[model samples]
Target: MLVIGLTGDVGGGKSSVALLWEKEGAHIVDADKIVRELWREPEIIEAAVTRWGSVILDSDGSVRPQVIARLAFSDVREYRWLCDLIHPKVMRRMERAVFASNRWVVAEIPLLFEVGVPWWVDFVVYVTAPPDERLARLSSARGWGEEELRGREAYLLPREEKIRSSHWVIENDGTPEELRAKAAELAEMFSFFSEPIEVTVSCGSEEEARRLSKAVIDRRKAACVHVYPIESLYWWKGNVEEDHEWEVSFKTVLPLYPDLVGIISKEHSYEVPVINMASVVKANRDALLWLWEELSGEPDNHAHRS
Candidate 1:
């Protein structure tokens, strides 16, 4: 089965791209939709009422997301606590879909890497939109105050990190047509079955971050996708504190790292945002190489790599 994970920051228009893929006839397993189902579970409501108290629940004993979103986003630990409660449930649902997919399947996994479930997918695709665009989009939609906006932003993995680790970057900053064009390219390529490569990609552009990721995976060079935020730390001339700018980490393969790095650097955002690299410390045998080859556009045999 061709299981692909899709992720993007808030307001990145990932759903828009997913629709384009749907038009092309891929089955979609939506993570957010599954999580929404969990929201209706009595256990979930009980947990919320216990933590945030009974007021968050409606008169009928249902959880009101807006209430929870406000309370949860107000604190990182609380938000994480909520994620801990819901993520596993979401995973179980995703697992069911993955097993059931007889043909190409697209799973809308907002936290694929964070939850560490991308390991099951043949590929991962991250949607990309500029941070300003994201902020603007959110603002226009909700008419939020600074505090509300910041709270929402705090819930997301840094965009820079998600973009850096992706295998395919669907730029959502453009018109729907532009995004659809990118999605089509991905659908065309994933039809291959030569196995994948494992490689780390330090990419600047969301497009490049994923392009290299898919390329390396398709090439069968490396396995496992590690994405983390790399903040540029600098001290103002006389300030004791250092300012943090963003960078991303991609852990893939030693052999294909150089080529991927070049492409990432060329496509990167910062004049010198680090396109960092690292080897996979541990991974499943065939799956590891399958990742790198799949991303690198040079699908190879997974058995030989092992």
Candidate 2:
């Protein structure tokens, strides 16, 4: 199971990214929702009353989040007190929810890094958007003033540090379609929608096939390459042609298919290499592991995308 902690600046579209993950079958545990529940808890209400007296409470005697925020943000000690009072309860609920989730769990923790909860996830995905855009979104969506937004944002770590700390970064400063595409790409890493690829690349001769096979395997492009002698019939230019050929089948992960195809084309003698690939819907776990381990040697610059 893969546990991904999703976080971002307030109003940076982390929830939008999380919705895409949810569509891909990820069990989403929203920390904001947990906080909302915590706000109404008797213990939290009592704690707020004890700390700030009646001012932080509503006429109905419940703790008002906005009132608490207004008081807490003005003083560091008050802020810490509020966090200490609520964070433990939030963590307890988060743990219970996560324990009952599916194989792919995505917890949307807006203050994931602030609360130091990244350590609990397999990896953290930080969503990013321009400050102007984020401020606009927050103002329009939640009716927060610029000063109010800035005040809360000031409490968090720097944007650059958050991006650096996270294992993956998703930029949400684009259209919804672009964001969805990036979301899908990131989803592939968790193997939620991942499938094996069978790549076919033909060679002029058995020697050429063996050389191609060896090169790809040694380079960790393919876990297993099978070279077979075969007769190929094809239409070239204006005439149908038949000749002896060698077929090379590369068993690899879907993510490596494009690279594998490029490698085959670069090594092939033919001007137009017979490169084709199809997804393997069901494959043995050991075989999949071998392919993954081989491809793991490659540098993952795309792992922490912006």
Candidate 3:
């Protein structure tokens, strides 16, 4: 799965972008939701009471996030202490959610860069809007004035640095439809390259390997086929056998696996060819995009033998 780190300045509409991706079938690991859940735990509540007293609790006996925010944001030392208490737990939960998901995952972490990018994230997307627009959003959404917004943002990494570290930067100054379009485009691209696989087939000879590779490419069964010489040893018919062979590896997505196997089986001379598939956990974006483009056309809608 492709894991994306989605972050942005306060009131920049990162959550809106995440929702769009979710609509496109991506799983959203929302950090704020996780934080709220953590805060509701008994141990966390007890710890909060110890640190800041019972005044942080609501009438319903739940921890008031706004109360904690107010107290923490007012003092740099208090803010750091609060983060120290909360961020590690949040990181663990976020990693668990991201790693457990099979679908394309979008992690909506507002302080992603501040806490450091997670190792599992494949890419980072930084959302931003014009200062005036962001200030307006903060005012309308959180009852925060310009000074308050600026004060809170002071604790974050600079906007320019965040943008520089990101793989994709989205400007949320446009209409919601425009922002949604950007999210949709990214979702599609990520989904297309999500499950890359490397199919390795052993051929009896270089000539056979070349022929099979050519057929696969011509039919668009795979994005690319690499042919190389190798020595092999195997047990066949109760005897050990050794031979010089050619290895052909196909770079393609999992959806095209059946087609690739069919082409190899049909064109190969070996009765029981060595066909092995390995999942590619990571790949270069440009190369994967090229692979996707090469095999973008519809697959053959026909049956194939084992």
Higher-scoring candidate on TM-score, 2 or 3: 3
Q: How close is candidate 1 to the true structure, as a TM-score?
A: 0.61
lDDT of predicted model 3: 0.85
- Cα deviation in Å at residue 161, candidate 3? 1.1
| RMSD vs true structure, all candidates | 19.9, 11.4, 6.5
TM-score of 2: 0.66
Rank by TM-score (best first): 3, 2, 1
How much is the lDDT of residue 232 in candidate 1? 40
lDDT of 1 by residue, 1-306 (tens): 467788877778888878877787688899989988889988888888889898798898887878888888778899899989999889888888877765567888877777875566766678768877877877898666656656676677677776676666677777777777777767654433222223333343455555555554454434444444444444445676443332334444444556666655655554654444433323453554455355555555221110
Give Cα distance to truth, residue 107, candidate 1, Å. Answer: 1.1
**TM-score of every model versus the real structure:** 0.61, 0.66, 0.84
Off by over 4 Å in 2: 193-306
Q: For residue 282, what is the lDDT in candidate 2? A: 48
Clashes of each: 50, 0, 0
Give stretches of model 3 more than 4 Å off. 218-224, 228-245, 269-275, 283-306
lDDT (C-alpha, whole model) for all candidates: 0.65, 0.79, 0.85
lDDT, model 2, position 228? 91
